[model samples]
Target: MILAADLADDRGWKGPNSATPEVVELSELLNRAKIYPLHDRPENFRSPSSVSRKIGNLIGSHPSAPRNALRTSAGEVPIVNRFVDDRTPMKRQAADIRVRIRRGLL
Candidate 1:
């Protein structure tokens, strides 16, 4: 998981199952670009994994799941899941982020 603070510090992050570091970095940059404009103050953000399950539910419900995923057997894939393990593809981790308006466990 990559923390917002780490990206702010230019420390960057790479997932264990990430196929390419550049892709992860690019995604981080994109997310940061969107987030920084809305909440410039670091103090305004929540701590990692401190968000409500409702928000988590939203993330889990949205997004197309990984290709060839078992979840895709239903013809679609979920983007995130609070109950998924690290091995679960596309499972969002709570510690990886600390957005201003939302947070959640995984």
Candidate 2:
């Protein structure tokens, strides 16, 4: 996930109008991205698994299952669960991110 995000950042988020303005505390980012995960079967939409396979494996899968993934087989993959765009509140996200930085998550 970090790698992919870095890739996205590297590529300037690809395509026109890709800027993730106000990524944190952004409703659209949270709504379109956040997920409640409960993975036991095949998923319907894309996830980090799909992202790694389809986008780039070096990006890596999100370490923890997303917050909104469900037990349903037809659940949307990246929706509500993966990092389509940034959603972590800037301040709250800092601590966790600092840990990641210390551990080289980026």
| Model 1 TM | 0.20
List candidate 2 stretches off by more than 4 Å.
14-81, 85-95, 98-106
Error of 1 at 58 (Å): 3.4
Residue 17, candidate 1: Cα error in Å is 28
Local distance difference test, each candidate: 0.30, 0.34
Q: What are the models' TM-scores? A: 0.20, 0.21
In model 1, how many backbone clashes occur? 2
Give the number of colliding residue pairs in candidate 2.
Answer: 13
For candidate 1, write residues 1-106 as lDDT tens digits: 2332122113222122222353354343334444555456354233223222222323233333233322222211222222232323222332234342233221
Q: Candidate 2 on 50-105: residue-level lDDT in tens?
A: 44332222222222333442222322334223344453532235445445545645
Worst 10 residues of 1 by lDDT: 8-17
